[model samples]
Target: MLLKTFGWSFAVTAIGLVAAVFYGGWTGFGVVAILSILEISLSFDNAVVNAGILKKMNAFWQKIFLTVGVLIAVFGMRLVFPVVIVAISAQLNPIDAVDLALTDKDQYQQYVTDAHPAIAAFGGMFLLMIFLDFIFEDRDIKWLAWLERPLAKLGKVDMLSVCIALIVLLISSMTFAAHAHQHGGTHVDKAETVLLAGIAGLITYLAVGGLSSYFEDKLEEEEEREHEAEEQAKRSGKQQSAVLLAGKAAFFMFLYLEVLDASFSFDGVIGAFAITNDIVLMALGLGIGAMYVRSLTVYLVRQGTLDDYVYLEHGAHYAIGALAVILLVTIQYEINEVITGLVGVVLIAASFWSSVRRNKRLAEAEGSTEGSGKAEVSSGV
Candidate 1:
């Protein structure tokens, strides 16, 4: 099972390291290794969240995710995206952007950094919407019951998540971004960039996420109705089949997953500059990390890990919320990637332990109940 799940990731790692060594020798190898680890650490929560969505997809769509999706992730997010940003921000052509990245890396890095305000705002807002929708959702399992219950109740209010996201965008833009501009710490138009980018993020989330959810719910409803009709037919005699996502529903879900990945990668792309400005190395390292994340998502689904550790999804979303906040904060202040990575790992670890404890308590209670029943039977005997 392990081999079936992680064989590709292992192969990618070996090949990636060999290529890294060939490119920049030991230093290149070490940087690639660190970048891979960094991407995985910061994205563990991303894997968990991805599993939840991926599990609902059909087998065909699942294959699409591993194949086409992987290409998009590796090349589109890690390599092409940064270049595109540089091209637009630097007012250079695509070829010039690529040339600049290879020739004048410092200038490439600066262009990428200059684009941070808008990037952070867009990614942060999109992730914030995800966290908000999750927390506000009324679910059967509540990891943080005290807080989640209250928030879920408030979720009944129409457009609550959108309202709150807009409010956050306004505050962050007005205070941190605007203050930076006032102090000459950033571009004269930083606040406007943040505001517009944030609005775009919010809209993207609503359009993509909302459509995905709508279609998925519609599909589920159709399935349920068909199942009920089959049961009715079985009164006379018949059979049937079902699927969670198909056709339009699956397509939207696929699009949503890609967008979610893009949002998550924004920080990693920016942070990679701090380690090295070599775009090839960043792509190789981050690409390897991304493959592992995809593998982990598949493993979790096949293993039923989420079903066993009920709070894992909750922990992941909390981590995502922390990340969203950190991204927004980084707009004004620099945040260490170590802190970002640690926040996710710690939350997920805590949730795992909590799940263990819950399982133990339930087992003990069941054992005691069985013991009492046996004693009563013996007394009767």
Candidate 2:
């Protein structure tokens, strides 16, 4: 399983590197590959969190994710998003902004940097709310009688979550609007940009996130119905067949994975400004980031590693929450992209090590139980 996962990832990486080499030679290819690996390492938690969500999606959506979804991720978010950011924040025509990016690489880099404050404010605060909501939200799974009622009640109506999001949006808008006015002066109206960005973020949160959640719930209901049908078939002494077809299953997982990938890519897409903004480099670096994220998702699923590392998901969500806070703070203060990535890596690494120790202890306990059972059997004989 490990070999297959590694082999597939290596092949994908090689393809991406080759494309980069053709576009910008060995130097460009090397840079992108390294950056991609770094992005992937920093985003392991993203894959785990995605898997938790993907498990709830329907099969058809998952297929859309693996195919068209990849296009959106590799191109839409990575290539187009930065350009869009620059165009909107700088008050330039989108075409002109993109042309500048393709033609005058240095100026384009500056534009992206100039635009980063707003991007960070919008995407950062939005992501922060997601993390905090997930963390503080009660998610207790109950099988008993009385315990299930309160746990179910806690699950409904995320009031605190809505309040936190509103606060982040208010703070982020005020700060970015002020920063934009300070830097761009007359060229860009800070208040207008901040207002637009805050609106954009709110819309994205409601549209993308709300839709994804709705679809996910619908899929879960369908899956439950199917499971019930399978149970009935079994009780009737009929042949037990696989109710969830592989293609269908793969499609749903793929779709949810793609949306999840897009959500996570918002930071890297925005952060690419810190590096050289040559459309080529942004595409290369961010593409590598996307590729690695895809590979990591597949690796996690194939390995069932999340099952072993119980706290891995928790850690990743926590890191997401931290990144969101850092992003929001950067609206007023400059937070380095490298630092953001490192914080996530450190947290995830700690969680992974914790999982490893936990598994080792479980194994030892099982071994001790088997040994005692063997001794008892011999004495009885």
Candidate 3:
């Protein structure tokens, strides 16, 4: 099962290692290895959240996710996306940006880092909404009942998630702006940019998610009509909705997944700069890590891991909430990547164990009930 599932990931890892060696000798290989591990550690929650969405999709989309999606994840976001950010933010031509990356890596890193406020504003708000919506929405299963239950109750307030997110962005921007003004800090100009970027992020989230829902509804309507016309006599009011145009749906989903990925990678890409400003090595390393993350997403979907571990999604969203808040804070200050990565990993790991314990308890109770029923039967004999 492992081999069949992760064969592609293993093959890609081997190629990445070989390429690293060829590109920069053994030192390059070591850098990519560390980069890959760093990406995986930082993105484990990403896999869980992704699986939740991917499973709702059909088989064709899932295959595309594993195949073409990996390419976009590696080259597009991990490589070209950062370059584009540099090119745009630095007001340099693409060629100049490329040159900066190749000839003067530090300059390239600075441009990308300089764009952090916009990145943080957009990504932080989008991610914050994701966390807030997840926590605030009603669910039968919850991981941190103490925290989540209250949020769930509060979810009844219309637009509560968006309101909370805006309030956070407002306070963060005002506070940071004030501090920057008082201290003559350079990043003070970020106040206005943060709000604008955050709104853009929120809009993007709404548009993509809304489009997906609209198409899904259309697909469902089409399915229901087909059932009524053809199978009405055979089966009653039963329908399994399928994508009307597999190709088109796959295309949109591909785009949606890429956007979602880019949001998640914002922090990772920035954090990589903290380690090293070598864009080439950063791309190669983070790219390899992204491939593994895609593989893990597929694994979770195929194995039905989300269904097995009910609280896994809750934990992943909670981690996202932490990261979102951290991103906003990072707009004002530097935070150690280790702390950020650890917070996410720890939340997910703790949730995994909680799930395991719950499963064991349920199994024991079930076994005892079965034993009691059998005893009654034997006594009658």
How do the residues 150-231 of candidate 2 rate in per-residue lDDT, one tens digit apiece?
5346547666666767776676666655654233333333555555665676567666676667656655665676677678
lDDT string for model 1 (226-316, tens) is 5676678679675444343245567766777777776667546654544454777888888898889889889988886756776776776
Query: Global CA lDDT of candidate 3, please?
Result: 0.72
C-alpha TM-scores of all predictions: 0.76, 0.71, 0.78
What do the candidate models score in CA lDDT, each in turn? 0.76, 0.63, 0.72
Question: How does residue 13 of candidate 1 score in lDDT?
Answer: 99
Can you rank all candidates by lDDT, best first?
1, 3, 2
After superposition, the stretches of candidate 2 with alpha carbons farther than 4 Å from their true spots are 1-4, 11-38, 41-68, 139-157, 172-192, 224-261, 267-279, 300-305, 372-381
- What ordering of candidates by TM-score runs from best to worst? 3, 1, 2
Candidate 3 residue spans exceeding 4 A from truth: 14-65, 178-188, 232-282, 297-306
Give lDDT tens digits, candidate 3, residues 15-69: 8889889977987777677667767756766787678768767787787777877
Extract clashing residue pairs from model 1.
Answer: none
